[model samples]
Target: MSMINYKYSFTILLAGFFLISCNGKKTENTRENNAENQITISEGQFKENGMELGKPVVKPFTEEVSCKGYITAPVNARAKVTSLISGKITSLQIRPGQFVSKGNVICAITSTEFIDIQKDYAENSAKFVKIKADYDRLKSLREENIGAEKDFISIKSDYNAASASLNAARAKLNSIGLNPANIENGKIYNVYTVTAPISGYVTSISAVLGQYADMTTEIAEIVNVNQTQLTLSVFENDVYRLKPGQIVRFNVAGSTENLLAKLISIGKSINTESKTIDCIANMETSLNKPLINEGYVQANIITAQTELQALPNSAFVKSEGAFFVYILKEKKSGNYIFEKKEVHITKSNDEYSAVSESLPEQETLIKGGSTL
Candidate 1:
């Protein structure tokens, strides 16, 4: 009877243990299933959040900068006209604002010196003719053995000297702006006409219709407005950045009309007074307006050049005064992530900066914070 009691008690204990184990197992399974469901829902919510926020947007790269300059004539050279001889200005053929072609008569002068030149040429020419006749007569006599060799030689010598004197006198006349043919054409006494040395507009005329002028007096000033050039002064610091043949844009002072030009020269020496270096630009075309009144123009010279990536200032976010951009990065779980990237901007222009490193040239950058 004691053995039976023991067996029954053992059975009861075993049954109780089994029931507790099954119950614990069911609870554990239930908890695991509930946790898995919650995790799945959380993951779905995270993905949905990503979709609701929308995909990150990228922007095209651009730059920002500000520069200044002006416009001027491309080719400007001036020539001053002066009288070579003392005389009365018989006629002032050209006045200021007159367009004169090369060799066009500008003014006329009547002078005693011109009269002397013509008289010398005529006297020497007459002597030359007389000597030639004498020489011919002497040569004939020498061939006939009727003239002495010395006499013949003297006649030849006289003839050669007369010819040389005539040539010298004619040259002198030409040197003084007298034409040899004009002297022969009976125009020797005519007032000598001063011709234009270059093609351009007459800028200044000091000679009046009966004004007295001499070698020391300037009769007129001819400016080849076509040869007009521009002179610009740049700061010393910007001087080193200039080069010959760089394109420049120019505008008249207080005028919005602009013209294209190029750098002809850059001053090597610095000005002591202004502490600036002069830069010269040449225009490709001429300006028809009164150029003298074009006034002082501003110049913008490009000194330095470099190619670098640039972005808008808004693309960057400031943290502790340092700049950073939110770069789009892909996570290992196939999710897009925003990773902060630090960049160094070397030089800032009006709208952009010159960076030291090349950004993804072909790739799109994050447009702005709104895209995130």
Candidate 2:
């Protein structure tokens, strides 16, 4: 090869190397700038935009398991008022939603059976008195050796029978809500008073004035609101998170205030149909607002808690499928720069969220982060 041609080829190779080196340097600088990306805004602009900065707080972080249920009364605090005897309802003094006290007259019922029962009691009382007098006289005579033993024995048996008949008659009147002692010979009661068996608010009234009610008929239902309980349906997967005495926050449908309750009992078996366990909670305090039995409720059962670095819910910004928060990086003159740091949220409540990420503890995080 000629010397001039060789020199030219070598120079072309060196120029190619120089161009490759320059391109590589440019790519490295681009990557470095991208890695340190930040947003700079003047302090005046930050204030105009209502941006706020705060520090991460170490607060109690609670993990809650949500469930739905209803308000209910304990079995002992509720009653199904019924008539002991078949009768026509003469008067109903109470209505649904009315408060009633124990032993208070709830209604008046009239029945022919009431009169019959009183009459039988009166007649048996008179008969028993006469039998007792005769039996006593026979015993006296026999003691004086002037009366036959057979006569004494027979009088004794008749007296015993009469006494039993009177007792049975008295029990019948009592069962119908009529005191036998109050029933006289001519004063037979046709109307019997049905009294409230428990002190509570009437939830239902099945009997109306002039309506015939039998023993099987339910006249009314009473529920003691002070003993109201919250029953929650927890699935099997979350049942283990519940324990007696755990606090529960709940809200009834159409109610704005969150009510408080404490778990008292948990069912041992899961419901076959709903695949849930029954958890019963008593109201922490008597409800000032009226709550109906079987009213639907949305509940949050706080299962566990721990101290964690938490921030207000607004501090976390969501983009695409990832969550991020702004960390105050540097401030020069009147300008502030903030760098975005990705975070993982572990738990959250209405106000704050527990977060986990590789972040400096002393760094100031922007509050109301969504505004940015």
Candidate RMSDs in Å, in order, are 13.4, 4.2
In candidate 2, the residue pairs with backbone N, CA or C atoms under 3 Å apart (3 or more residues apart, or in different chains) clash, namely: none
Q: After superposition, how far is residue 241 of candidate 1 from its true place, in Å?
A: 2.0
Off by over 4 Å in 1: 1-76, 140-146, 185-187, 285-290, 293-295, 305-372
**Residue range 124-207, candidate 1, lDDT tens digits:** 887888899999998998889996899999889999899999999998887767777766666667566677877887878877
lDDT of each: 0.67, 0.85
What candidate 2 gets wrong by more than 4 Å, as runs, is: 1-37, 40-43, 134-151, 184-186, 240-246, 264-273, 330-337
Top candidate when judged by lDDT against the true structure: 2
Q: Can you give the lDDT of residue 72 in candidate 2?
A: 95
Worst 10 contiguous positions by lDDT, candidate 2: 358-367
Give one digit per residue, the lDDT tens place, for model 2 in 323-359: 9888888889999888877889887877888876744
